[model samples]
Target: MVTSIILMNVERSKINEVAQQLADTEGVSEVFSVSGTYDLVAICRVPTNDDLSELVTRGLLTIDAILKTETMLAFKAFSRHDLETMFTIGLDGI
Candidate 1:
């Protein structure tokens, strides 16, 4: 899976509507209304780079309320599960 962090600058009057639209879009897993340079942040998961492009360019940009967006591609994902698995490796002797 390919993960991306999309930061969106939405029209001030339509932040809620834009967020809802993004959340409803396929491949978008989560949407957050954040206080920062960007009005909203969307987490997306897709199968390929081409799908990511379609989602952000064709799908997300089509939202009339979204003024601009910045997409960040994730190179790797580190989670508690990964840490636990690492620490547990070869620990049976303990």
Candidate 2:
């Protein structure tokens, strides 16, 4: 999967609306309202680079409330949740 962390600058009045839209968008796994230089952050996981491109250019950027965006492509993922799942693969029956 191609994972993208998208930082978005949205119009102040539309932050909530835009976040909801992003969360509802296909390929977008999560949307967070954060405090910092950006108003919101969206985590997207998609099948291919082409899909990511389509999602950003056509899906995300098309939102009128989104003033700007910075997309970061993830090369690798390191998470404690993944480690825990790996170690517990078949322990559920116990």
Candidate 3:
């Protein structure tokens, strides 16, 4: 999967509305209203780079309340759960 983390600066009045809209979008997995430089953060996962591009350009950027956005493409994913699972793979047979 192609995962993208999108940081968005939205019009203050429309933050909640925009977040809900983003959450309902097809490729967007989650939307968070955060406290920082950006008002919202959206996690998007798609099948290919072309799908990512279409989601960002056509799906997200089209929102009028979104003042600005920065999209980051994930190269790799690491999680404590995954690591633990990997290390314990053969333990169940013991």
Off by over 4 Å in 3: 80-94
Residue-by-residue lDDT tens digits, candidate 3, 9-89: 999999999999998899998899999899999989899999999998899867999999999999988842344455676
Report lDDT (Cα) of residue 85, candidate 3: 53
- lDDT per residue for candidate 1 within 1-94, as digits (tens), equals 9999999899999999988888899999889999979999999999999999999879976898888889999999775234445568696434
TM-score of each: 0.82, 0.84, 0.83
lDDT of 2 by residue, 14-78 (tens): 99999999989999988999999999999999999999999999998679999999999999978
Q: Give model 1's TM-score versus the native structure.
A: 0.82
C-alpha lDDT of residue 30 in model 2: 88
Best by lDDT: 2
Clashing pairs in 2: none
The model with the greater lDDT, 1 or 2, is: 2
Clashes of each: 0, 0, 0
Positional deviation of 90 in candidate 2, in angstroms? Answer: 18
